[model samples]
Structure formats: structure tokens, C-alpha cells
Target chain A: MRRAFSRRRKPWFAIAVTVAFFGMLYLPIVVVALFSLNSQKSLTVFKGFSLRWYRAFFADHDLIGSLGFSLRISAVAMIGSIVLGVALALGIVRSRGKLGSAAGLVLLIPLITPEIVTGVASAMLFKGVGLPLSSGTVMLAEVTFSISYVTVILRSRVAALNPEVEEAAMDLGCSRFQAVRLVTLPALLPAILASAILIFAMVFDDFVLAYFTTGVTPQPLPVRIYSAIRFGVQPTINAVGTLMLIGSIALIGLALLVPRLFGRRESLSQLL
Target chain B: MSETSAVRLDGITKSFGSSVAVDDVTLDIRPGEFFAMLGPSGCGKTTSLRMIAGFADPDSGSVLLGGEDVTYLPPNKRNVNTVFQSYAVFEHLSVADNVAFGLKRRGVPRDERRERVGRMLDLVQLTGMANRRPRTLSGGQRQRVALARALVNRPKVLLLDEPLAALDLKLRRQMQVELKQIQREVGVTFVFVTHDQDEALTMSDRLAVMNGGRVAQVGTPEDVYERPADAFVAGFIGTSNVMTGTYADGRLTLPGGVSLPVPSRLGLAAGSRVGAAVRPEKIWLSDFEDGMVQIRGTLRETVYSGATTTYLVEIAPGVQLSVLEQNIDRSRREERWTGGEIIDLAWKPEHCLLLCETA
Candidate 1:
């Protein structure tokens, strides 16, 4: 009788823990989505569903321009991060002795240091150099921080790889560069792609560094949303937020699916 | 194609801090002969192989390939290939692409590259799995892919760093035979590194035994096994029943006051101490006989291993000796020797080898 009671309660205990964990994470997002569909322009009370706020957000040219600017900046930053990150990871991993350890610590500085410190210091440096603070500066800041993350991820992946593959390639009549390009790069492609997706998402969602570095004329989406929230609790803001949340979710899902589909050949190669 | 040394190492030495990994040593590998460097771990066999591959530069000494000084040449410039222990297959490419990588980089025409890759895949018996990934293949299949990738370039020499170390017992045994056949078929000078005595003995035309960063012995497997130069080589090559004794007048005096006739080739001076090594199968066991050099010992254990029955006999205080006998039939006479029974152990003069005792 005791064993039957315990077994019946075990699944309930598992379900309770899972539901509690997800509720703590996504309950706020669900509330925001509900408010976005409410007819009344108030967050505290629920109202009947309406599409007026969604239509208003779509028609707003300024908001759309800000979103476009954010996308463009993130795209550039992600590209820059991936290139610099991969190079740095390779250099550090190949270095020997004390030099390698020193290189590793240098790459880790941006990853471990406070983000605000990096942001303010970079802003000051750019100002001192007499460079105009613009969306480009924001992209530069985001790239600086995101590249460190990319290096850390890619370095671990590269370190885990067997050096014998590169030796085998060179023995096969490939030059050093060709060996790296043909063997090393392909082995690291999945990790590089994964880092790029992560960096893109990070740069897209970043606000503190962008706020300090962005110019006056062209605020990024985060900055626009911040200012709009400070002014008033408009239903259109909720509509914009809901659309962005949905779009980001879809993009992350696509980023995850692409590697599985295209990387099948790569997985096969690894088997060989 | 020219008449030159295939691969040569002159006074090569490598050190990490104060500890020397590869002591100053020189060797030459002939064209199309399988040479094996056999040693235990930390004996610098792998280090020597790495220096030849240009992955690690020697602290001193020069490396030559085809009589050209390639000591400072990068690995890419050398006409040599290696089949690594891990097989090192690129995880992101198909087996065909991995095998074709070298040919592709040489700017071979695409059609020619495809033909060569297909031939190599066939050579390694991985033709049907060209499009399959390495992870999907068995350990032996991956090893063959690695072999195909290295062999496709038709290098002057091939270096294998314990290539069969990862396989299970059955696969490793099968691969041992296959590797020997493949090396002969390719007709390329092969330099293999391994610690397994059976592997070195079965696969190599000549085996170089290394110990403590030094070449202990280099000879044919039979020469090394039958006539080991030192105590380490004697103990390492195969199982041996060893006893230390003093030599005088073509006779060896054991600890128990038993003097046995020595082999004629061991020209040791009288009163000089030496270690005698005799194979287990060579030792004869029988009931005690008068007027014969013999040692009395008790049979401690008997193990019947289908082909042979091995008896563990205690020859002296704290000293155990192993005796092996061919199992011709399950006769009562053979089964009569049980544990705790006294037995006499003896061997012929020619069966024992005199080895140098290391200081």
C-alpha cells in the first residue's frame, strides 16, 4: 500500500517542480502578451481583445526605422565578432607555455569585467579620439564585448579538436594555410555558427552600452522603447514589444534548425 | 625517384626545460621497408616520430628526406605523411572529402581528384561509405579512412603513432594483419611506434627497442628475441625465466651450489657475474636424477591453457619460476604433478642466453 501511494505521488512531484520553474520564467511574458491584446490602454486591468494597438505600431515609421537600425547594427557586430573571435581563439590555442596562458587571460578580460565599466571606458576613449558617437560606435562597443564570448566558446571547441587532423592534412600535400582552411575551419564551423547566433542575439538585446554610445538622431530599438516607456504606458508599446518577442523567438528557432539541416554533412565528415 | 636516403635523422635531441625527451640519436629509414620503434611510455619514441614530422623541431640534429635537408622545413613542405593514433578524421566533411582534402589542396583537376579519392577509398575498403560521416563509422572504419587520407598522397614515408591502440582486442589483432598487408602493398617506407611487443614483432621488418630516451637494441625480431643484448631487452621482448649466477670455465654457478654448463657463445671471464635468461618452454621438468645439474622446487600451481599447460614452481625462497609444456594428450602421467609436489627443473646449455646486468 505504501509503495503504491509513493509511486502515484512521484509523477505529481515532478510535474509540480517543472511547472513552477517555467512559471517563474515565462509568467511575466504571458502577462505582457495579454496586456498587448487588451482593448483598454492600461496594464493593471485586463480588457477585451482588440487589434487597434497592433495596427498603430505597424503604421509608425519612426518605430520601424529604429527596429531596422538595430537589426543592421547587430548584423555587422555579429560578423565582426565572429571573424576577430575565431582568429584570436586560434592564436591563443596554438601558442605555447606562458605566452599561451597570457593570451588566454587577455581574451578573458572582456568576458569577466563588468559591462558598464567596458561601456563607459570605450565611450570615453571614442570621445577622446574625436570620433562621432553614432550607431557605428554602438556596434563597435557591442562587438568588443560579444567577441570575447565568441572567443571563449570557440577556443574550447578548438582545444577539444585533435591536432592530428591538421598534421594529416599537411602530410597530404596541403600547405599550412590550406590545411587550416580545409580541415581546421570545417571542424570549427558549427561552433563558429553557434557563436554568431549567440552574439547576434546578445547585440540585438543590449541596451546599456548602446545607450551610452548611440548618437542623438538615430536611437536603436531598445533606446526608443526605453524612452517610450518612460513617457507613458501606451498600448502601441506593448504591441511593438510583443512583435519583437515573437520575431526573436522565431529567429532563434531558425538559427537552431539551420545547423541541424545543413550540418548533417559536417557530422558525417566527423564520423570519418 | 632519385637514388637518395628516404628518411634520415642525424643527432636529433629535444628537451622540455632541463629534461631531455629525445636524447641525441640518429637513424635512417630505408625505402619501402617497415621499421618499428618499440618502447614503453616516456621512452621518447613518439617524440622522435614528431620531430620527423616537423610538428616539433629538434634541439639539435638535422632531418633529411630523400637526401634533402628538411630539418627546418615545415610539415607541409615534407613529402611524408602520418596516420595518427586518434585517426584525426575531420568531423565536418564526408569520408570522400576528408580523403580528397590533400589532392584538392594540390590543385589537382577535379576529375582527377575524384578518381584518386575513389581509388584510395577502395584501397582502404571504405568505398561505399565515401559520403558517410566519420562518426557514423566503426573504429576500424575510421582508422581505414585515416589511412586512406594519408596514403592518397603517395608519400615517400608513412609514420603511424600506435594507430591500432584504440581498437578492441579482436579488431586490433585483425588490423595488425591488415596493416602489414597494406604496408607491403603500398611499398612505402613505414615508421610505426608502439609499445606492444607482439605488434612490433608481427608487423616490422626491423624493430628498434627504446628505453629511457635511448635506443636499447635494433635488429630483426628473431635476433632481438633470441639474443637480447641487455637485461631490459631480455625482460621486455618476451617472457623469460632469469637467474643471476657467476661464470667460470664454461659453467654457471647458481645460488644453490648447482653449476650448469653455459652456452659456448657467452665468452665471460671466470669469476664474472652475469644474468642467465632461458625461455619457459626450453626448461625441462622431471623427477630428480643423480649426477645432473638440477634445482629442486615445489609445484605451486598448474594452468591448462588448451594448447599448453603452464606450471608455477617455487625454485627457491621467494623465487617462483614458470615452466611450460605442450599438451599432446590428457595422460595420467602429465596430470600426476599436483600442487605441493617436489620437482626438478633443468635446461640444456644452448637454451640459455647470458645478459648484461645494468648498473
Candidate 2:
């Protein structure tokens, strides 16, 4: 009786549900991937396999410039958010009293607030302050939006760290700043790297904020693709989307792998 | 206390909100002495140790090291180091790098740093594991790493906050001996803190038994154990059977109307309530001698441990005393007295400690 209850039996219903779930999620992506390699410009039919759209995408200097623009924005936002985010995490975890707790609760607003709301508010703030809408504004908006992601991921890591380790560093002859540099930062590096990768991917794929805050010439890739799609559904858009999907997948993979490189086995779910 | 005391805390007190953590703690830790602060949890032993290491500032009074006041100095500026209870070894750095952290910060030359790190690792028996990350080491080895990391700095005084607390029983015992040996070899005044009475007794040259944010007693292990200062000291350092009763002349009258003769103490009044304590091993079940106080009681229970046996004997209603005996002469072990037998418990007069009750 125990063996019958404990035996391994496949439930066809669960298997079908799982298969349906993944198919629904990935079938559109698979179609885009397949059509990115199409030789003809027909959405409903598959043509002979060719890199025609990819070749066209590479030849378009405007699209290439947007791609480079998005990459630069993501890099800057990643570094900028990480520096501010890690410091905010340490401060929130160490500080006591109402101001610290209020700041902590306020930090979570961006994570839950609608991205479009933040984008509109940021653009209006820049305009109201007599600042022009440009790449700098977009970078600023992206960095502000991405700081919450970095801080949320890093807060628990900071809380889990032994406060005594920092004291031990200080006891070992390092000054306050030196203790953080020598001990606390190294301990948080794994989490920081993981969050940096996450922020990079999020900023790279952002559309609403970049669309609202970007300048006229070199828009972010997602905004450029939106403009190109509004004109006509170019097969080149599919190529760009496919490449971006690959890039983000690689970045997410790096986010999951970096902690293990630091000899920590924490998965991304645990981090978030 | 002498001016050359290695570490001194003069009337230090600390409070967190409404609860006091350490109150009026004044102590003089002599040079090259292995001192221990022994207490149960929340007794302010760790708080006092933190104040000494400059991690926590006292609400009042000053901390002095070699006659130099360090009350306001940060931990880095002070000549002291700590081995945390959790063995807070830096997991990111290599063992050698962790040991050399202080020397590097103090601008020690590279060659001298390497030499000192190598020597410290050897001293802690972690010579071959210098290049390994702390994550790969065992708990005992990690403890040694914490020890070597703190000890390598060669501070005027090394503060250990229950450093062996995370190890297993066998490993803790082994490390206790090893720690004492290392303290002697280095000749640095070690201010050890622990809650285990056995560890404190076995390792400390002098120890302060703390209770409720105050030093209940401070002396050598023998002084604290053999002659505790008061009721709290008597009950904490070892198992003591505290019998509360009223005293008159040279006799104590229990609540059950049974009267027993006790040694007259100077400060004890004729009609005052008092508590009398006697160590378990001091009471004997057989071979009674002259001038020994003997009482007949009914054996309530027998607890046979490996090296010793304890018998719970009820001398009066609601009054029980635990008498401990060595389990020597194994041939007579099985033939010993069983429960519910009438027997005599005897102890010398001086063994009964009297504490005058205030309330």
C-alpha cells in the first residue's frame, strides 16, 4: 500500500498543462525568431531560410546608432544605479528611527509604482526645471527607475551580513571607510554583481521611460523600433527584436551565474 | 588597582532605552593574564567585552588601556582586536589575506606582513590552508582562522567574545586547551568571555561571574567556585542546595519545624531569615565522622551518572537535598541503597554557607 501511494506516476493532465503554459509563453517568441531569418516580407508565411533581414538591420546606420545608444544607456544606468543602490541599502539597514524607516518604505514605491507614471513625472520634472529632453534626461530617468531594482535586491543581502565582520575589520586597524572598502563591499560583491546585471537587462529593454525622455536624433532601440513599426512593419524590426531577446537572455543568464562564480549558490529568486 | 593594569574599566555603565545592559562595571585586568567574563545570556558579559574592544561606548565612565584612556577612540585607533562569537572570518578573502588584513592596513612592509601571517597561521595550526577560502574550511578550522586573524595583530589585549561557542563539544574542549596554551605563548592579556562555567573554570586565570548587569563576584576560578560572595554567586557557579529558614543562636529552623545546628556567623542576627547553601559533593551518605552534622532522611530518588551518583533525600516535608557521591569501588555499585530507604546525610559545619536575607 505504501509503495502504491509513493510510486512515481505521471499525471497526463499536469503534463498537458505545463506544455500548454510554456507553448503559450514561447510560441510568439519562436515565431519572431523564425521570421527574423525569413527571405521574404510576409508575416503569415514562412519563406526559405536566409539572413536577409539581419543583413538589412546591420546596414541601417540609424538602427545601429540606436542599438549603441541603448547599450550606452544601460551601461551608465547599471553603474550609476549600483553605486547609489548599494549605498542606500547599507544606509537603510544600519540607520535607525523614523526617517530611516520612512526612507525604506519610500524606496519601495518605485518598484511597485507604474513605470509610465514615473516616466511622465520624470519628463515633466525635467521640463518644469527648464531642462531639455535629451540623452542625459533619458539616462537620468533610467538610472532613477533602475535604482529601486538594485536596492531591493541588495537590501536583504546587506541585512544578512554580520555586522561584526565590519567591526572585525575596524578592529584589525582599518578606518571606517577602509573597513567598508576592505570587508563589507567584498562580502556584498556577489549580490551587487547580480543586481547590476539585472538592472542592465531592465534598462536595456525599457521602452516607456526611454520613449518619453529620449531626444529626437538617437532614440533608444525600443523607441526607434516603435517609430519604425508605426511607419510599416519592417522585417528588420523582427531581426532587431530577436537580437535584443538574445542579448537580454544572455544578461539574465549572467545574473544567475555571477553569484555562483563568487561561490554563493543563491538563485535569482532568492535574491529578488 | 595598579596603574600598569593592562585593561581597566572605571565605573562604566550602558543602557538601551529602559533596560540597563552593563551597570557600574569597574575591573582591572592585569598584564599577561587570561581573564574571562563568565555569565548567562543577557548578563552583560558581551556588552562589557564590546565596551573594552571599543565597539560600544559606555553611557558613563572611561575605558583605559595601559593607563591611556580610550573611552572615545574608535576600534581602529585603539590597540585591541576581537574574535567574535560567530567566528566572523572574512569569507571573501583567502585565509592568509584575512590574517594579514590588519598588518596591511597599518602599512606593514610586504615581506614582514607575509612573515607574520605565516607565523600566525602556523601558531593556529592552519599552515597548509592559507590559500584556501574560509567557505571550504570546517567550523573548527574557521574558528582557528578567526583566532589567528585576531591574534596576528599583536594588540596589547586580545578580546575573545566566546570564540569557541560555535564548535562541537569535543572541538570546544580541545580548543579551550589550545586557546589557553596560545594565550600563554603569546603573553598578550586575553579577555575571554563565555557562558559555560566549565570553560571559564578550566581556562581563566581570573574570572568575573556576572549576573543581571553586575559583577556578582570576581576572583580566581578556585576563589569564585570554593568561596562565592553571595547567594547569586553560589547558585550560578555550581549546583548549590539553598535552604531558606529562620536562624536563632547557632541553629536554623526550617518551615517544617525541624531545627538544624549551623555555624554562627558574625553579621547573622538571632531571629533573622537566612539562606543556607551546601555543595552537593560536600555532603556524604556514609562514613560519618565526629563533629559532623548528621540528619536522617528518606531517599526520594537516585540518579546514577557515570562518574558520580546523586541521591535526593527528603529530610522534612517539602525539603529535599541532593547529595552527590563518587561512583568509586565499582564492586559495591549494584549493592548501593535504593529509593525509599531511610539514611543519614552528613556534612561538616563549615560547608553550610549562610546568607542573610534582606527581603
Candidate 3:
């Protein structure tokens, strides 16, 4: 009787826990979205629905330029992270014994250290080197932190791969580069693509690093949003937040969907 | 493609840290011959195969392919392919694409790659499944696809590292037969690695038994089985009842004063310690007669297998010997040598193999 009662109640308990977890994550986002559509400019009380804030935000050239600047930096940073990450991952995986373990620990240090520390140290290093503080410097700083995450993720994927596959390709008359391009790279593509997307999202939302690295001319979207929030909350800000949330959701959705579509191809190859 | 040795390993030695994985070992794999390196785990059979394939470099040896020194060449330059134990099928491509991967890397024309991949798929009996994913297939199907992927390149030598170890008993038996047929059809030098004695004996034309990071013996299955070079080979290759003894005047005297005739060509001096190896099937149970040395003992246990019956006979206070007999109907019931029954065990003179005692 006890087992039967517990089994019957288990699914309800699981449902309650799942709902609570997701509710905690999405409820605030939903409230912000609702307030963005409210007629009143203040968030404390809601009036009739209005698209006035949306129209005003779309007309704001400064917000548009900031968003564009953020996109460009994230794009560059993602590519930089992938290139540096793949090389670091391969090097760490290829090293042998104690040296390999030591290299792995060194790579993981950047990932575990505080992002503020990384930002401050990188900013100071650029200043010391006499390089101008620009969007490029911002990209460089964010990439320094983002690449470690990419490398740590990709290294595990590369290490889990069977070494025999690459060897078999080489044994079949492929050069080392050819084998890697044909076999190893294909096996690692899913993880590499996923890591790139993750790095891009991280760079896009980053504020502290951009704050320490940005120049006087062009600022990233997060820095712009931070300045706007400090002045006093406005409905235009909520309007901008809603749009950014939608963009993030769309980007994340693509990240999830693209893998599913490409993953189907992988399953087909295994069939052969 | 020439009628010469396809691969050769001269004095190959590979070490990992302080442990020598592959000691100085040399072997020549003839073209189109199916050879097997047979040993238990960590005996360096896989390491030696990997060295020949160029996946691993020997510490002090040369690897040759068709008379060309390929010791320093990477695996990509070698004329060999491997079917891994895991099958290692590309998870993100169609069956045809996976098979065409090596060809595409070699810059084969798209049309020619498709044609070759199709032919190879048919050869491995996986033609209709070209568009399906590997995960959707059974283990046997995935294995065939891996074979097609490797064979499509038409490499000079194909290496198989325990390719059938993952299958169930029935499937493994089926694959063993299929693998032998495939090797014959492809006419490639097949270098197979396995730890199962039955697998090596059944599939290989010539087999090398490895032990302690060294080649204990290399010969045809019958040669190695009938005349093992050492105690390790004798004990590893088949079921053998071993007894410590001394060889004198072409005879082996066991610890219990029982004497058995051995071949005179062993060339062992009198009183020299040796090991006498006799297969269980060679021993017979009967009453003792003149000119025949026998060990009188009571039967301790009997095991009735489908084809043969094994008996555990206690020859003395502590020594026990195993004997196998064919399961004839009359012998199965009438000659039921139950526990505690006194029996005399005997064997022919030539059946005993005198081996050097191992430290």
C-alpha cells in the first residue's frame, strides 16, 4: 500500500518541482515583456496597452548603433575563440603524461578565475603595451575569457574521440591534415559549433569586461544598457529589453535547432 | 599489389614510461595472407599491429611496406587501413558518405567516389542501408559498414583489432566466418589481433603467440598447437595437463616416480629439469600392462560436456590430473568413472612434449 501511494504521488512531485524551477527562470522575463506593452511609462503600475515605447526605441539611433557594435564584436570574438580554442584543445590533448595534466590545469585556470580579474588584468596589459583602448581591445579581452570556456568544452569532446578513427584514415592514404579534416574534425563539429554559439552569447551579454576595455567612441550594447538603467528606469528601456530578450531567445533557439538538423546527418553517417 | 611481403616489422620495440609494451619483435606479413597476432591482454599484440599501421612508432625498429622504408612516415602515408574494435563510424554522415570519406580526402572524383563506395557497400552486404544512420542499424550492420568504409580505399594491408569482440557468441561466430571470407575475397594482407585461441586458430593461416611483450611462437595453427615451443605457449594455446619432470635417456620421469617416453630429438641431458605437457585428449584410462608406465589414482570428479567428458583424477596425495574422453554412449554410462574409483591413466610415448622449465 505504501509503495503504491508513493508511486502515484511521485509524478505530481516531479511536475511541481519542474514547474517551480522554470517559473523562477521565466516569470521575471514575462513580467518585463508585459510592462513593455503597458501604456504607462512607469513599471510600478500598468495602464492601457501602447506601442509608443517600441516606436521610440526603434527610432533611437544611439541604441541601434550600440546593438550593431555589440553584434560586430561578438562575431569577431566568436571566431577568435574558435580558432584559439581548437588549437589549445588539440595541443592539450596531444601532450603526454604529467606535462599534459599540467597544461590542462593551466587552461582551466582562466575558466575558473573571476571574470572581473581577467578583465582588469587584460585591460592593464593592453594599456601597458601602449595599445589604444577600442572595440578591438574589448573583443580581445572578452575573447581571452571566452576562449578558455570553448577550449575546456572542446578538449573533452576531442579527447573522448577514438584515436583509431584518425589512424584508420591515415592508414587509408590520407595525410595527417587530410585525416584530421576528413575524420577528426567531422567528429568534433557538433561540439565545436555548440561551443562557438555559447562563446558568442557570453561575449554578447558581457558588461564588466567591455566596461574595462571600451574606448571613447563606440560602446557595446550591454554598456549602453547599463548607462541607461543608471539614469532612471523608463518604458523605452523596457521596450529595448524586450527586443533583446526576443533576440536572445531566437539565437538560442537557432543554436538548439541547427544541431538537431545537423545531428540527423550524423546519425545517417553512422548508418552507413 | 605486388606478389611480395605487404608489411614488415624489423626488431620493433615500443615502451610506455617504464613498461615495455612491445619488446624487440620482428614479423613479415605476406601479401594477401591472413595472419593473426594472438595473446592475452597487454602482451603487445595490438601495439605491434599499430606500429605496422604507422599509428605508433617503434622505439628501435624499421617498418617496411612493399620494400619501402616507412619507419618515419605517418600513418596517412602507409598503405594500411584498420577496422577498429568500436567500428568508429562517422556519426554525422550517411553510409555512402562515410565510405567515401577516405576517397574524397584522396581527391577522388565525386562520381568515381560514389561508384567505388557503392561497390564496396555491396561487397560488405550493406547496399540498401546507404542512406540510413549508423545508430539505426544493429551491431552487425554497423560492423559491416565499418568494413566497407575501410575496404573502399583498397589499402595494401587491413588491420583488425579484435573487431568481433563486441558481438554475442552466435554473432561472433557468424562474423568470424564472414571475416575470413571477406579477407579471401579482398586479397588484402589481413593482420588480425585477438586474444582468443579459438579465434586465431580458426581464422588465421599463420598465427603468432605473444607473451611478456615478446613473440613466444609463430607458426601454423596445427604446428603451434601440436608442438608448443614453451610452457607458456602450451598452456596458452590449448588445454594441457602439465607436470614437472626430469628428462633422461629419451624418457620423462614425473614427481611420483611415473615415467613416460618422449621424443629423443629433445636433446636434454640426464637429470635436467623439464616440463612434460600432455593434452587431456591424449590420455587414456585402463588397467596397467607390461612395458607401460602408469599412475594409479582414484577419480575425484567428472564433468559431462556435450561432446566430451572430463575427469579429475587424483594421482597421489595432492597431485590431480585431468583427462578427456569422447562421449560415446557405452562409455558415457557403462564406463562411468565415478568419484573414489581406482583408475590407471596412460598416454602414448609421442604425445608427451618435453619443454624447458620456466623461472
Against the true structure, whose lDDT is highest? 2
- How good is the docking of model 3, by CAPRI class? medium
TM-score of chain A of each: 0.85, 0.94, 0.85
The residue pairs in collision within model 2 are none
lDDT of each: 0.83, 0.90, 0.83
Residue B110 displacement in candidate 2 (angstroms): 1.5
Off by over 4 Å in 3: A1-28, A97-99, A262-272, B1-3, B264-267, B286-294
Residue range B1-359, candidate 2, lDDT tens digits: 43599999999999999999999999999999999999999999999999999889999999999999999899999998899988889999999999998898899999999999999999999989989999999999999999998888899999999888888999999999999999999999999999999999999999999988999889999999888888888888889888878899888888788889887888677888888888999998878899999988899998888888888999888879998888888423536676898988899998988765421
Best by the TM-score measure: 2
Task: Using TM-score, rank the candidates from best to worst.
Answer: 2, 3, 1
Compared with the true structure, the alpha-carbon lDDT of candidate 3 equals 0.83
Top candidate on DockQ is 2
Chain B, per-candidate TM-score: 0.91, 0.97, 0.93
Q: Candidate 1 clashing pairs?
A: A268-B133, A269-B93, A270-B91, A271-B133, A271-B134, A271-B135, A272-B133, A272-B134
Classified by CAPRI criteria, candidate 2 counts as high
Model 2: how far residue B134 lies from native, Å: 0.8
- Model 2, C-alpha of A1: deviation from truth (Å): 19
DockQ of each: 0.67, 0.88, 0.62
Q: Worst 10-residue stretch by lDDT in candidate 1 chain B?
A: B286-295
